[model samples]
Target: MAKHLDLEEQEQLDEIKHFWKQYGNAITWVLIAVLGAYAAWNGYQYWQRSQASQAAAMYDEVEKVSREGDADKLQRAFDDMKSRFASTAYAPQAGLLVAKTLYESGKVDGAKAALTWVAEKSADAGYASVGRLRLAGLLMDSKAYDEALKVLDTGMTEEFAALQADRRGDILLAQGKKPEAKEQYLKAFKAFDDRTDYRRLVMVKLNSLGVDPLADAAAPVAADKGAASK
Candidate 1:
C-alpha cells in the first residue's frame, strides 16, 4: 500500500510538471500583463491625485492675485496654471477669474482673450457655456452683435437655452432689429419655466414687444373650455 501510494504521488507530480511545462510561459505572461496593468493604474491614480493637489495650490495663488485686482499678476499666475496643469478643472476656473480681474481693471482685450481661452479650451460643457455667455456679453458691449451671436452659436447647452435666447434678444435689440428681437424674446419666454421669476422677466420682455406668451398659453385652455361647452 505504501509503495502504491508513493507511485500515485509520483505520477501526480509528473502530471503537474508536464502541465507547467506546457503552460508556464503563457501563465507567466498573463500574470505579468495583469500585474503591470494594476501597477499602471495605481501610478495613474497617484499622478492624478498629485496633479489635483498642485492645481488647488496654484488656484489659491490665482485667487490671491484676483482678489488684489492685479490683472498683471493674475495673468502671470493664470499662465503658470495653464502651462503646468491645463488638464485640471482649476485651469478653466483660473482663466475665468483672470478674465474678471482683467476686465474690472480696464483690460478689455485681455479679458476677451482669457474668456476666449475658457470658451475654446474648457473641457466641461457647463464651463464652456458660461465662458461663451460671458464672452458674448463682452462682444455685445463692443457692439460686435454679429460676432457675439456667432460666439453664442458655438455651444450653448440645454440648461442655458432660455438664457441664450434672451441674450440673442438683447443683441438683436442692440442692433435695432426690434422684430427679430421680439421673436427671440418669444422663444425665451417659451423656454423659461413658469415657476421661475426669470420667466416673469421674460414676460416683461415679451410684453414690451407687444406680445403676451401667457395670453397665448391661456388660449389653449380657452379652446378646451369652448369644446367642453359644445
Candidate 2:
C-alpha cells in the first residue's frame, strides 16, 4: 500500500509538470500584459492629475496679476500658460481673465483678439459662449452691427437667451427697426425671471418703443369683454 501511494503521488507530480511545461509561458505572458496595462493606466492618471494641478496654480498666478491690472505681467503669464497648457480648462479661463483685464485697461483691439481666440479655440462650451458674448458686446460698442448679429446668431444656450435677446433688441433699435426691437425686448422681458432687475430694464425699453407688451397682451381680453357687453 505504501508503494502504491508513492507511485500515485509521482504520477500526479508528473502530470502537473507536463501542464506547466505546456502553459507556463503563456500564463506568464498574460499576467505580464495585465500588470503592464494596469501600471500604464495608473501612470496616465497620475500624469493628468499632476498636469491639472500645475495648470490650476498657473491660473491663480494669472488671477493675482490680473487683479493688480498690470497689463504686461498679465499678458506674459497668459502667454506662458497658454503655450504650456493650452489643453487645460484653466487656459481658456485664464484667457478670459486676461482679456477682461485688457478691456478694462482700454486695450480694445487686444481684448477682441483674446476673445476671438477663446471663441475659436476653447474646448469648454461655456467659456466659448462667454467669449462670443463678450466679443458681440464689443462689436456692438464699435457699431459693427452685422458682426455682432452674426456672433449672436450662433445658437445660445437657455441661460443666455435673455441677454442675447437684449443685445439683439439693441442692435435693432440702432438700425431704426422699432417694431422688431420691441419684439426682441418683449421676448427678453418674458424670458427673464421677475427677480432679475434686467426685466425692469426691458420694460423701460418697451416703453421707449411705445409698445407695452403687458398692455398688448391684455388688449385682446379687453376687446373680448367689450364685444360681450355690446
Candidate 3:
C-alpha cells in the first residue's frame, strides 16, 4: 500500500495536526494546574480532619483529668492540645473547659492564663468572644476594674453584646458607680430580648435603680389620661 493519503483525508489530517500544534501545550498546562489544585484541596481536608481528631482526643484527656481533680495533669493535657492542634476547634473548647476547671479548683491565675490564650490566639471568633467575656469577669472579681473594663471593650462579638453590657454594669456597681451601672444595665436590658430570663434579671436591676423600663412609656399614657380628665 502507498504511504500517502488521498486529497481530502490529507487536508483533514493537516487541520488536526495544526489544531494540536496550536493548543496542545496550553491544554496540558491547564490540566496540570487543575489537577494540582484538586490534590492540594484534598490534602488540606485530610489534614484538617486529622487535626480535629487528635485535638478531640487531647480534649478528652483534659476532661478526664479535670474530673479526677488533677489540675496539673489537666494543664499538661491542655498544653499539648494548644501547642499541637491550636488550629482545630477542639483546642479552643478544651481551653474553655480547662479554664473553668482551674477556676473551680481555686487556680485563678491559671484560669486567667487559659482564657487569655483563647481570647488572643484562637481562630474562632465566637470562642474568642467567650474567652474575653470570661476573662473580664475574672478580672472584675479580682477587683481589677479598669483592666476588666478594657478587656470587655475588645473582641466581644455582637451576639454577646447583652452579656457584655450586663457584666460591665456589674463591675460598675461593684465600684459604687450607681449612675454608670444603671446606664449599662439599661443598654443590657435593650440588648437582651424580652423573652429571655437574662432580660428579666436586667429588668430587676433597673427596678432597683428606680427606673422601670416600661415606666417611660407608661408616664405619657398616665399624663394623657389626667389631662383628658381635666
Candidate 4:
C-alpha cells in the first residue's frame, strides 16, 4: 500500500511537470505583458502630473509679469509658456493675459499677434472664442470690417451667441449696413433674458436702428389675436 501511494504521488507530480513544460513560456510572457502595461500606465500618469505642475509654475510667472504691466517681460514669459506647455490650458490663458498687457501698453500689433495665436491654437473652445471676440473688436477698431465679420462668423460656445451677435451688429453698423445690423441686434435682443440690463442696452441699439423690439414682439401677438377674432 505504501508503494502504491508513492506511485500515485509521483504520477501527480509528473502531470504537473508536463503541464508546466508545455505552457510555462506562454504564461510567463502573458504576465510580463500585463505588468509592463501597468508600469507604462503608471509612468504616463506621473509624466502628466509633472507636466501640469511645471505649466502651473510657468503660468504664475506670466500672471506676475502681466500684473507688473511689463510688456517685454510678459511677452517673454508667455513665449516660454507657449513653447514649452502649449498643450496645457495655462498656455492660452497666458497668451490672453499677455495680449491684454500688450494692448494696454499701446502695442496693437503684438496684441493682435498674441490674440491670433490663441484664437487659432487654443485647445479649449472657450478660450478660442474669447480670443476671436477680442481680436474681432481690435479689427473693428482698425476698420477691418470684413476681417472682423470673418472672425465673428467662427464657431463659438452657446453662451457667447448673444454677445457674438451684438458684435456682428456693431461691425455691420460700422460698415453702414443698418438693415443687416438691425437684424443681428434683434437676434441679440431676443437672445438675452428680459431681467438682465444687457437686454435693455440691446433695446437701445434696436431703437437707434429705428426698430422697436418690444413693438415687433407685440405685433405678432396682436396679429394672432386679430386672426382669432376673425
TM-scores for all candidates: the values are 0.94, 0.78, 0.91, 0.87
lDDT by residue for model 2 (154-183), tens:
746678889889989998888788888888
Clashing pairs in 3: none
Candidate 4's C-alpha lDDT?
0.92
* Per-residue error (Å), model 2, residue 21: 7.6
Report the lDDT tens digits of candidate 4 across residue range 79-128.
88988899889888988988888998999999999999999999888999
**Local distance difference test, candidate 2:** 0.88
Q: Each prediction's Cα lDDT score?
A: 0.91, 0.88, 0.91, 0.92
Residue pairs with colliding backbones in model 4 are none
Runs with alpha carbons beyond 4 Å of true place in candidate 4? 1-27
What's the lDDT for residue 73 in model 2?
A: 89
For model 3, the run of ten residues with the poorest summed lDDT: 1-10
Candidates, ranked, TM-score:
1, 3, 4, 2
